[model samples]
Target: MNKKVFISGSISIKKLPKEAQKSIDNIINKNFEILVGDAKGVDSLVQRYCASRGYYNVKVYSIYDAPRNKISDKFRFEKVEVSESVRRKRESERQQAKDQAMTRDCDYCLVIWNGRSKGSYANILRAKELKKGLKVVINN
Candidate 1:
């Protein structure tokens, strides 16, 4: 079976470095089905790249629809929406759900860490707790 990978990363696109961009490209080229939240920043970049490359199997899970940005129209993806109520709840539960979904659906979780964001840290903890294979891509 083809490997399925969940992509979690800094939403701050402006902070992404050249190395991080290349790493994401490499990962996408490996034919791993990508799972990401289709928000702004790195998520948007990855989704747009996959779409432009004709990667049909990419899936986006987000709390909202595509952001109001100018991503290319060619990027097509399956979207799973997480209800807003989940975000309003306790942080632990939200992180649990995110981790659960990723673990249940993906073979590996690739996290692009930008800095000291709490959400990113929570994801790291969740990945560790689930014992899923993780690849941490640091973009400094």
Candidate 2:
């Protein structure tokens, strides 16, 4: 059986860390079910790489009514909603919902992070709270 891997990372990086890319490539064969969000940055980078490689065993979840990248259409999708108060709504909260859902659905997470961004940090924290293992690929 294949493991379900949840992937997330920072938005600030224009280039992915070599270790993170290695981790991604390592998990992307026929033995993995991958999950990722539909947001930009790491999500987009992973999605593009997987799509280009014709990986179909992926789920691209996103918040309701949000436009995702075109390549994400190739995979299955789950539309999510934010529980935050509408009056205080923010895009980050919406993305949090999507990433949180990914956390809940995966056996573990691969955090492609540089150890500073909030979103990637939140994903690591959420996985820790869920008692799921997180393999962090720190920047070199």
Candidate 3:
């Protein structure tokens, strides 16, 4: 089976830096299956890049049944089911469930942080706590 990589970053990042693009290119070259979120910012940019390249080995993990932004219909959708209590929490808390699910499912992870996003930092910490292999790129 192809290795699965969770590529994620801060929602505050409006652009994908050269480093991030290069990292993604390396992943694509290795034919890793990508597990990503369905959000604005980095997620959207990542989706667009992969779609532009016609890379269809991507799965958009989301808290809802349908993702908010899936750049291509070719990508699969993975809905991580959370408890009712979690669904009632703040949006960030709810989104974290999907992030955790992606972290659990990935063989490797690439986190692009903008230095101040608590959510992105949380993902980095979660990957560490789970002892998953990961790379972090500080975009800020």
Candidate 4:
């Protein structure tokens, strides 16, 4: 089976830096599967780039029943299930459900941080805690 990489980043990052693109290119060249979230900023940019490159081995994870933004409908959609308590929580808290699931499922992780996004930092910490090989690109 192909390796799976979780690509996550700060919601504040609206563009991909050269380093981030290079990391993505490496993953694509290796034909690894990609797991990404459904959010604006970096997530949307990544989705668009992957679609432009014709890389379809992607799964967009969401906490809701459907993704808010999926650049390529051909990519698979995964709705992570959380408990009622989590569902009732704040938006970021609820979103963590999907992030945790992706962290658990991926063999590797690529995070593009804008230097101050708590969510991106959390993903990095979670990946380290889970012992997944992780590369972080600081965009700021």
On lDDT, the candidate that comes out on top is 4
Q: Global lDDT for candidate 1? A: 0.65
Tens-digit lDDT track of model 1 for 45-125: 767666676675676664334533325444344434456887788854554465457556777777777766566667777
lDDT of 4 at 66: 84
State residue 134's C-alpha deviation in candidate 3, in Å: 1.1
Put down candidate 3 lDDT per residue, 14-125, tens digits, no spaces: 8889888998999999999999999999999999999998899999999887899999999999989999999899999999999999999998889999999998999999
Model 2 residue 68 CA deviation in Å: 2.1
lDDT of 2 by residue, 36-75 (tens): 8877788888888787777878888877665475365668
Per-candidate clashes come to 1, 0, 0, 0
TM-score of 4: 0.98
Task: Report the CA-based lDDT of candidate 4 relative to the real structure.
Answer: 0.94
C-alpha RMSD of each candidate structure in angstroms: 3.7, 2.1, 0.8, 0.6
TM-score winner among the candidates?
4
The predicted structure with the larger lDDT, 2 or 3, is 3
> Runs in model 3 with CA error above 4 Å?
none
By summed lDDT, which 10 consecutive residues of candidate 3 come out lowest?
Answer: 11-20
Rank order by TM-score, top first?
4, 3, 2, 1
Whole-model lDDT values for every prediction: 0.65, 0.80, 0.93, 0.94
TM-score, model 2 to reference: 0.87
